[model samples]
Target: MCKSRILLVEGRRTVGGGQIMSRRICDVLSTNYDIAVFLPDGESPLAELLQDYSLHRYPMLEYHSGKKGVSDVCRFIYNMWRTCRVLRRFIRKEDITVVYVQAPSLLPVVVCAVAGMDVQIFVHLHVVHVDRKVRLLLNVCLQQKCVKKIIGVSDFTLQQLSLKNRRKSVVLYNYIDDCIKKTVSSDTCEKPVISVIADVMRIKGHHVLFEALQSSALNVEVLIIGRIVEVDYYKELIDKKYSFQYTFTGYVNDVERYLEQTDLVIVPSVGFETFSLAMVESWGKGIPTIASDLGGMKELVENFLPQYAEILLFSPGNIEELKVKIETILNHDILYREVSEKVHEVAYNNFSKTSFRKKLLGII
Candidate 1:
């Protein structure tokens, strides 16, 4: 019997959380489906990661961070038309039955709706909050007959959509990749190593972590592993003096190596997190993480990993509280080991690849 064909659409050119999730979804689905990815035309960082799957290049537009102008509007219109045309042709040529969009994009879903290919559209929402315009667009797309379902990375993300949209939405947590699962835990260092695996942005709360480190007398070495998206903010962070020793490894491909050596992981984000892949991945490796008690991070720890409860979560950007949590872990070895072992067991049982694939198959 022939397998159903799927076209995975990702609009972003750079490697980030959304791209990582998209790649994992493709990897899992490719076993049962004839899967191909549609990416923005250029040297995408995802190209190296998705070498096993077939990729279809298109003249996809990059995400604009600046204010919209008349030229921006014109470009948006042109890109939409171009993308729709390309997708329509690919669907017809490949006889694709399903089109799974990685991040919520209005243009691609609209294209699939009107393409007249008898294809089902699945939009996986990775963002916790979207602007009014994008939210409106998503609502309109969700109403389309061709759009089968809306997948959210977390409950927080699903709640952001309208009530009508919620009926058709489902929450699917991101799973730990095989590479991270293969990581062997190392012995705790003489001076404990704490790891943070988010881009250097203000919203990610790098400054808050530095402040916590400065205020505390804990002797821990910090390992920061991510790209420097905000140059000025990063420069500002590095320029200031701190009490704790830290090293920044900008944009490393393999995060498992750093995760393995560290005694603990910290996710101190001031902004809302849809779902933290870093936290889940670290837990899968039997490592305990101290995350900000906000958004999905709070939900994941409090609800999913309730064993750790109050001990693992701290108020977002609260340096004193964060410092206290870190010190608690560092000061007490028994507490640290107990939390680590329990969290790893829970994560492995709940967030394994086998469980994720089974859930995904049910939806597909």
Candidate 2:
């Protein structure tokens, strides 16, 4: 008997949680299906790791942070049309029966390409969009007959869709690497080390974290991991007055190594966050986190560690509240150790690679 064919599509040109999950899906599905990866024509960690697979690249237009012009609109339209045409042809030629689109930006074109075809469409959403226009377009596309399932990284992500559109949706939380859990150690430092593992964007609330740390009397150091996605934002962060010492390690491939030294992880995202692999990975290392009580971060803590939600979550962009949470963890050693152990157990039981692989295989 011939195995089924699956085309996994992703639009990002960078390495993030979404790209990692896409790679995970490919690895798990390849056991029972012939996998083909569709990506933007560029050099990225995902691209390099997936070279051994059937990979296809195209000149894809990505939605980034910028002011849109008429020329930009025209270019996006042309690219969308071209991408749809190319994808439809490829699907037909390759005899693909299942199309798994991993990014929301590529959903419109993918929906159009697979419309009225015999193929099944699975859309996996990683980020939560706040823009009304973007949400409207996504809702329309998801309502199509070909879109068999709308998979959200968290339940909060699926809540953003229309009631009618949500009928075909399911929540499949993202998971951390199994090896990360092994890095957990019974380590403690005199001066607590709080690390924020996210790109330097205003939406990530890096300045808010710095401001909170400055007000605290306790001595703490910060490790700002990931690349500076926005230069202006980084400049603003550096120019601010903060008493706590902080270092920026621009785009480190081995993030777990840094987590090993960290006592606490802070996720201060003011904007919509569907899910945070950083927080999960930190937990897998038996590290406690104080995350902004927004979107999926709140959902994860409230659902998984409900008794510790008050200790783990802070109001988004609230300097005083965040400052208090950080101090609370650092001042009490017992509380810190207890939360750490609980998070490690949660990560192992809920966010393990084995659990994710089993569920994904069943979903597809």
Candidate 3:
């Protein structure tokens, strides 16, 4: 059989969910199909990532949001045009069979429409791009004529997508590797550790986490391990000098190292997560999570894996609810231990590398 060529179009170079998703696709299909990925510029963790896999990559114009105004808008448009040019060239050179658009921002649907190549197109909608109220673009490229499949990381995401395009897309729950599982100890001891591992974003609801920690009676030290999305947002919060017993490890490269000692990882987010890699990784490592009952993660924590019931779910942006959830876990050792016992079984069955690879093979 002739190997089908797959091209992934995503924006960033760093190790985030988008890159992780692309890696899985490459891992699954590379054994049977030729694969190449398109990143904004050839300067990302992906460049290093491609070295380890049977994969290839390319660079287009480096698109960075300039100052927030008309200037930024102009810069975005110019970069996208350059990206479209790269797509034209890449299609002719690689003889690609399918192009996967990773995000609405970086890989604009317009490029694929103009490629004029008979390639299958998949839009992996990772977020509800339209703001809180739900907005969408009517680009004909997304219409049935151009695009073939639309993949939403969660069922909640599919509902949001249905708001704009009345098309029914596939819901593929994000997968985690087995390494996320925690080692089972024959002897167990109660350790005091509770944390929220997520990027510092307004919608992610770090404030709710802060409130939860303040309310907890346990000596709960929140290990904050993620990069800042907005400088002003970080500054506003930092200037106040937060009150929780918090160790702000602003953007650590080694999260797993922190996870090793953690008793619980909190994903108290107020916004929509296409899928929380933090939650998946923590669950895999045997560390239980407490998350917000918001968008996609609700399905990830509640329905898919009920064994992780310790992952207390609270209302989105609700500080009081988060406070109660955290207190219950901190106050009860037996409840935490009961859920902890099931972590290895859940992680191995749901997120093992072997299992994830199998899922990918089936998808591709």
- Residues 48-164, candidate 2: write the lDDT tens digits: 867878998877866654344566567669778998999989998998999999977888888888877898999998877766667788899898888899889999999879999
Worst 10 residues of 2 by lDDT: 179-188
Quote each prediction's TM-score.
0.93, 0.94, 0.83
Question: Which model scores highest in TM-score?
Answer: 2
TM-score (C-alpha, index-matched) for candidate 1: 0.93
Preferred candidate (TM-score higher): 1 or 3: 1
Write the number of the candidate with greater lDDT, choosing between 1 and 2. Answer: 2
lDDT of 2 at 156: 92
Higher-scoring candidate on TM-score, 1 or 2: 2
C-alpha local distance difference test of each model: 0.80, 0.85, 0.65
lDDT of 3 by residue, 301-353 (tens): 67656655444677787777777776676566676666665654566677666
Ordered by lDDT, highest first, the candidates read 2, 1, 3
Q: Show pairs that collide, candidate 1.
A: none
- The CA lDDT at 342 in model 3 is 62
lDDT of 1 by residue, 1-364 (tens): 8889888888777787888888889978988998988887877688777767888887865555434456656666777788778778878898888889885654443455356668888888887534566567668777777878888888888877778889988988888864244232323457888889999989899888888988988787999899999999999999998888999999988888788687888999998898899998888877888999887898889777776767889888899998998888777877877777777777877787888899988898
lDDT of 3: 0.65
